[model samples]
Target: MKYIKIKRVMDFIFSLILLIVISPIMLCAAVAIKCGGQGPVLFKQERPGKDGVIFTIYKFRTMRLETEKDGHPLSDMERMTRVGMMLRKLSIDELPQLLNILRGNMSFIGPRPLLIQYLERYTPEQMRRHDVTPGISGWAQINGRNGIDWETRFEYDLWYVKNISFLTDLKIFLGTLAVILGTRGVNQSKSQTMEEFGVATKSLKG
Candidate 1:
């Protein structure tokens, strides 16, 4: 109880400080996004958070809106603009999530919130990830991020949830910084981002 309260306080304080420090960079990112192409400056999507609650997650728009000859949307790589590519490489596109942290919709450290549509796809054990607030970075992210398989990712998330502590969060936070600086595991092979978890096998009932 004490730790949870302390962590929440730390999250609030750090989020505010970082928001102030990164305002200029965020403004620059917004302008760059506008100059890159047409579309909203921010991309908002509903994601499952702590206790399976849903919240709108915010990110800087990094893809151009376009349709194919069949009127279907193009792949993420196809829609990625030059500036978008740069922003993604530097992870500047994730800065908007600071607002989520400020709103208490997220934490600085926890399992990364996944799409809401995946709720029914999770196995009973996997569903434990929602036991804590989602985060901009997590044990899974710092481990192998998009480079790992879904099973491994969930295992890492569960591990973090079961062993969450100040020291653990600090290690994951620092590891995230290293991963971002190295620009590692930003995307999976043959995809601009990690693939979504669609319908799960019937054997692994949610």
Candidate 2:
């Protein structure tokens, strides 16, 4: 569809512009992470994108290097640092995903990429959310983000799949600004993040 093509162009242009504009902030974030003695400034993870194809998603590291002296991974709260929390609350940690957008692995507005393990868990209908490229922000993100349940999130994803258009993307683009400024749904008040898809486990970051 023409809209899909147009959306890709928009993603490319916007991601490039955003990267240029935010480079300084990203630089500062990298310095802060290094100063905090965290493992790395950027966190890379394999996430499923369109049609369940895996791609590396990037984010600024927001967790401590280790939770235990024995090389064990840290629990969500244990790994969270003050700097990490501040970046997360400001939604600055996700700025690295603009690179994903530029790389053609993602869109600026679509269903947010999810973990690879979720490929097997999604029902046939839920899997439809992957019909388009995954995004850094999406209809689901603007709706409730980390606060919403898996079922509802999937519903929003599916809705976007069926209703994608320039106007829809514009609305999401604007709504994302509001969400970021307000930090309304970075994490659920009852918990740090929504439970993992079909797993009930917490995530690395919200």
Residue ranges of candidate 2 with Cα displaced over 4 Å: 67-74, 189-191, 201-206
Per-residue CA lDDT of candidate 1, range 109-178, in tens?
9999998878888888999999988999999999998888787888999999999999999999899889
Candidate topping lDDT:
1
Q: Write the per-residue lDDT of candidate 2 for residues 92-180, one digit (tens) a residue.
A: 89999999999999998889888888787877888898899998889999999888887788889999999998899899999999999
User: Which residue pairs does candidate 1 place in steric collision?
Assistant: none
The number of clashing residue pairs in each candidate reads 0, 0
Model 1 Cα displacement at 72 (Å)?
5.6
The TM-score measured for candidate 2 stands at 0.91
Prediction 1 TM-score vs. true? 0.93
* C-alpha RMSD for every candidate: 1.8, 3.7
Candidate 2 worst ten-residue window by lDDT: 197-206
Candidate 1 lDDT at 80 equals 80
lDDT score of residue 6 within candidate 2: 82
